[model samples]
Target: MKAKPLRRLFIGFLLMAVVSTLSVATPAHCGKCNIHLLTGSEYFYALRDAIDGAKHSIFLAIYLFKTDNHPTNRATGILNALLKAAKRGVETTVIMERSDDPESFINVENEKTGRRLLRAGARVYWDRPDRKLHIKAVVIDHHLIFLGSHNLTHSAMKYNQEMSLMLNDDRIASEIINKISRFPKTPFKRQP
Candidate 1:
């Protein structure tokens, strides 16, 4: 499949992930929330699912949200999912690494990506540029959370091996949200 079409299909899948939220869930035993151990593509898919299904908010604290022009195009792919959720009035916000890797193209493209997200109506925050915020986390609708080592990059999505947890727990999610609220915020600068 061509990269552009694959990208479009990923967009469709993201829309379905949100619109068909029921598919992402199963009956929980006696009110115990569901949790899944996501690895590889499952990890990224689950993140997309949660963001798509979000009714209230999506908060992301990512280490790197880099994009590439490869055929896989995992970089720009995920941004569509994020912007879709934001367009749906999901209150999407991203807190990206402040001190980006000096030698990383991912870091450079991420600033550009942030600009795209801003145009898409999402709030993008850069964590204190003085310090490195090496976290990859997402909180959706105050209940679901994804945390792990996956960067929002093509390698992390399709090529590299990565691990993350998909959880449906409001207690811990709330606590994390409160903690994120205290993190020093750095404004995103639009690339000229």
Candidate 2:
């Protein structure tokens, strides 16, 4: 009688313990959120390869993009690659920050790049005038997403110490895409 009750109690405790252990052993959400960190020339190459490999779509939001066609300009290279991708029927969109002062050189360069991208068949938009969108990210086919401090600039890729994380998680990618779509668009900020 008492022994039977005690045995039942022990069995229940064992079951609970097993369940707890299993839960603990299981990988937590975001635990396997495959993330890679790249730097220097490797970083640029990784981004280029990712862009070149994109088949469905590419979404890019950056703070700056160079206008001139300098041979050694990193931004120009990335821009040209993106344009090529767009021309190849890959859906591409670029969102840039709105210039605070209308006459700033940085603003001019950004405007020129936006126009060029639009001409290449990529949709372009500017961030809200009140708030600048400083996010640097690239999402390909909603499967791979790269987010970091690397701007579309030569120094960022060649000399600056920048950190970028590439994640292949679909859940995370969808979350980021939703967040990006929620950003407010500014009106007539550029030719695009």
Candidate 3:
């Protein structure tokens, strides 16, 4: 009868609606990708954990790595993690920003932090003074990457609202490392 056909059509439409909703809720192309969208203070703990767990290597290029003596500052914790990673024999490399003017705040802060890491046995390099290396990126073990606007500073990590992504993609990580490798290792006079 006509009622039976109408019922079947309604059931089919209901099934399609459910299917569409399910597809909309879940992405279809996410196949082996694991990504975390970090916002605000989330970057601090995630980066610290990655550095703490690094077994092979940690390559970091940052615009700023200003560290302070604040006991609970998140950026300080991340800095300590890098130092520990270096001490544990992980091949740690840090490329920092240097300004054309030596007395700039970013220059002074980066130098202080870079020296601290160097004394802890990490290899540190200064980017060309003419070009600003304003990259806040970390490639850990060549398998994980942290890239975004979150600088390694107390204000950026703790107070200011920031966003970053932690992705587990080797190809992207390699590309980032490659880009960082090309940065000129220009030498600058260190403060005694």
Candidate 4:
């Protein structure tokens, strides 16, 4: 009788251990989605590839997209990719931060980059001055989402310790896209 009770106790302990291990190993979310944590320059490469591979549509709402279009610029590739995507018939739409002060660094750079994108057939919008749209997000093909701290700037992409998540969840992507679409489109003049 003693042996039987000891065996049961040992099995119970083993079961609890296994359960704990499995729980730790499993993803916290219940959704069947693939999540990749992108850190530092990894985000740039991933985003470049994602943009390059975009087929139907690409929606980008960014806080800062500063670029000089220089050959050696790290962020130039991403800018080129967006322009290329638009040229290739992909519907690319960009919503950038519009500062209250037009001559602000963010405003100037975003306008410059936005003009380039606009000329390439991409629809560009500036957020209202009163409301700041500091979203750093990209949705590709209504299926893939890149959301986090990584901005389309050289420092953030190449140097800053930025972190972002690439989620391959259609439901979440759809929700994000809807939200992005609803962002107030305030018109602003593009500098020549």
Candidate 5:
């Protein structure tokens, strides 16, 4: 009788240890998160690839949507990918930040980028001025989400050591999509 009781206690302790070890191995809810780290040009490649491969829609929100276009430049490759994605019937929507002083370089360059996107059939919106819209994210088809510190600028593309996290989870993606849908839109001017 004593041996039987001791064996049961040992087994119970072992089970609890195993359970605790597994649970504490990583942060909570990490099983479903599937986050992948993206750094530097890897960010650009994955973003461009996702836009290129998108079947239904692409949603982009950025602090600065500035890029230089040249045939030999990889930055232009990203811009062209967005345009081509829209041309292929992908419902592409972009939300960018706008300041009250439109003459600011950040605002001016962003507007120029917006017009190019507009001409290519991408719907562009400036966030409401009550708050600064600085979120940088891209959601594709309600399945993939990319969020990071990167601004779509020449420096970000060429020099800065930027970081982004790519998540592929439908539940999280749906939540993000629903939240983004509520952002108030501001007027965008078309360039002549």
Candidate 6:
């Protein structure tokens, strides 16, 4: 009788191990795949295209967005695109770094951009932290995600060596959106 119970327990354990292994191997949304790897100019073009094609929503989390009065600055163009998207009923959100006074040039520019976006019916957020928000990504319509080292700056798009991945999969987009949703909101105070 004891032997019979031991045999049953061993079988149960083996079945549990197999189930665990299969669960680990098979993730949700297995159809999602890496469609394109963009680099240099192609990366920027892909980003621009994704931004322009956004239909439902646009979420941008960048480290910097230069708004200085320079003829070659591309921040203006990016901001304009976001504004246009907002105007067209596409919900837009820009999460940028927040700077202090005396060094508040970027902050000032971002404030103006935020006002414009709000007027155009878009939400804006400034990350207040000692360490910068070093993520650069744009999630559109919750169906595609363009993410990598490209920032919303002129140099990143035109001169700097950059790389990005254009993932045309709903699974990947959902994962990115979930991660972004977990980020802390404003008035972030570090806890000891």
**TM-scores of all candidate predictions against the true structure:** 0.76, 0.79, 0.81, 0.82, 0.79, 0.71
Clashing pairs in 3: none
What tens digits encode model 5's per-residue C-alpha lDDT throughout 109-140?
78888888888999998877567888888899
- Residues 30-58, candidate 3: write the lDDT tens digits: 34769999998899989999999999999
- Candidate 2: regions farther than 4 A off: 1-28, 187-192
Clashing residue pairs for model 5: none
lDDT per model vs. reference: 0.79, 0.82, 0.88, 0.88, 0.82, 0.73
| lDDT (Cα) of model 1 | 0.79
Clashing pairs in 4: none
- Model 5 CA deviation exceeding 4 Å by range: 1-33, 190-192
Query: What tens digits encode model 4's per-residue C-alpha lDDT throughout 109-134?
Result: 89988888989999889998788888
For residues 1-192, write the lDDT of model 2, one tens digit per residue.
799999999999999999999999964456567888878666678888888888989988888776477877877878888999999999998888876677666677789898888889898888876887889988988879888898888888889998998888777778778898889975334542
Q: Which candidate gets the maximum TM-score versus the true structure? A: 4
Provide the clashing-pair count of each candidate structure: 1, 0, 0, 0, 0, 0
**Residue 104's C-alpha lDDT in candidate 6?**
66
lDDT of 3: 0.88
Query: Model 6: per-residue lDDT, tens digit, 126-171?
Result: 6765546788888888877778888777777788988888877777
Off by over 4 Å in 3: 1-31, 187-192
Q: Write the per-residue lDDT of candidate 1 for residues 88-176, one digit (tens) a residue.
A: 88898888875544445545767877888888889998787677788888899988988888889878887788888888888878877
Q: Higher-TM-score candidate among 1 and 5?
A: 5
Q: Quote the RMSD, in angstroms, for model 3.
A: 10.3
Cα-lDDT of candidate 6:
0.73
